[model samples]
Target: MAGYLTTHVLDTARGCPAQGIQIALYRVSGNSHKKIATAETNADGRTDAPILPEGKFAVGTYELIFFCGDYLRATGQTADDPLFLDQVPIRFGVSDGAAHYHVPLLLSPYGYSTYRGS
Candidate 1:
C-alpha cells in the first residue's frame, strides 16, 4: 500500500476530542524545516484528510507541531501567559515509504504524550 500520515488528538483532562486544534507537518533535514502540510482537527479530533497523503509521502525525518494553546484557552484550560504545553512538536523518522503511519496525541493543559499508532 502507498504510504500516508494521520494523527488524532484527545483532551485527556477533559475526556473529549480536541477540536479546532491546528496541526502543521514539516519535512526536516538537519537544521532546516520545510512545512509541507497543515490541517485542523475536527470534532472527532482527526484531520479531515491524512496530514501527509500517499502522493506526497516521503521517507525522512519529519515534525508535527500541534497547536494546543488556542484549544486550551477556548476550553478554559489555560492559566498563564506561556502555556506549559503549547505548540507541541514531535519529530520522528519514517523508515519505510509504503507503510501507513498513525500518530496520536493524548493531551492535557500542562502535558501531552504521543506514540506511533496503527
Candidate 2:
C-alpha cells in the first residue's frame, strides 16, 4: 500500500465537526510556495477524498491553511470583535512519503491545535 494525506476539523466551541471549512495545501520551498490542492470539510469535517493521493506524496515542507474566520462567520458567529484566530496555517514536513499523513485540527473561536495522527 502507498501513502496519502488526510485531514479533519473539529469545532471545539460548537462541540461538533466543522463542516464547510475551506482549506488549501501548499508546498513550500524557501521563499516560494506552490499550491497543491484545495478542499472543503464535509459534514464530518473531512474531505471527500485525500488531499494528497498515494502517488503524490513527497518529502518536503507543506502547509495547510484553514479558513477559520470565514467558517465562524458562516456558522452564525458574530464578527463584532476581532477574531483571535483567523486563517490557521499548519506547516509541517513529510520526511517519509511511504507513510500516511493524518493531520487533524481542533479549532475554536480563540485558538486551534493540530497533530500528526495515524
Candidate 3:
C-alpha cells in the first residue's frame, strides 16, 4: 500500500470528537525544524485530507503539535490558572513509505495520550 499520514483527536473530557482543534505538522532534523502543514480538526476530530499524502510520504522524523489549550477554552473547559497541558507535541519516525501511519490523540484539559492506530 502507498504510505500516508493521518490523525484524529478525541476530547476525553467531553467524550466526543475534538472539533476545531488546531494542528501543525513539522519536519524535524537534529535541532532544526521546518513546518510542512497546518490544519484544523473537523467535526470528527480529523483533517479532511491526509497530513502527508501518498506521494509526499518519506522516511524521516516529524512532529504534530496540537493546540490543546485553545481547544479546551473553546469547549468551555478551561481553568482560571494556566493549563498544565497547553500544546501537545508528538514526535515519531517513519521507516517505511509504503505503510499507513495513524496517530490518534485522547485529550483532556490537564492530560493527553496518543497511540498508533490502524
Best TM-score among the predictions, by candidate number:
1
| Runs in model 3 lying further than 4 Å from the true structure | none
Per-residue lDDT of candidate 2, residues 1-118 (tens digit): 7778999999988999999989999999998999999999999999999999888888899999998888888887657467777789999999988899999999987778899999
Model 1 misplaced regions, further than 4 Å: none
Ranking by TM-score: 1, 3, 2
Instruction: Give lDDT per model, in order.
Output: 0.94, 0.91, 0.91
Cα RMSDs of all predictions?
0.7, 1.2, 1.0
Worst 10 contiguous positions by lDDT, candidate 1:
77-86
Q: Mind sharing the TM-score for model 2? A: 0.94
What is the per-residue lDDT of model 1 for residues 1-118, given as tens digits with 9 covering 90 to 100?
8899999999999999999999999999999999999999999999999999998998999999999999999999888898888899999999999999999889998889999999
Each model's backbone clash number: 0, 0, 0
Q: Give the range of the ten consecutive residues with the poorest summed lDDT in model 3.
A: 73-82
* Distance from true location, Cα of 85 in model 2, Å: 1.8
For candidate 3, list the clashing residue pairs, or say none.
none
As a whole number from 0 to 100, the lDDT of residue 81 in candidate 3 is: 64
User: Model 2 misses residue 17 by how many Å?
Assistant: 0.4
Give per-model TM-scores: 0.97, 0.94, 0.95
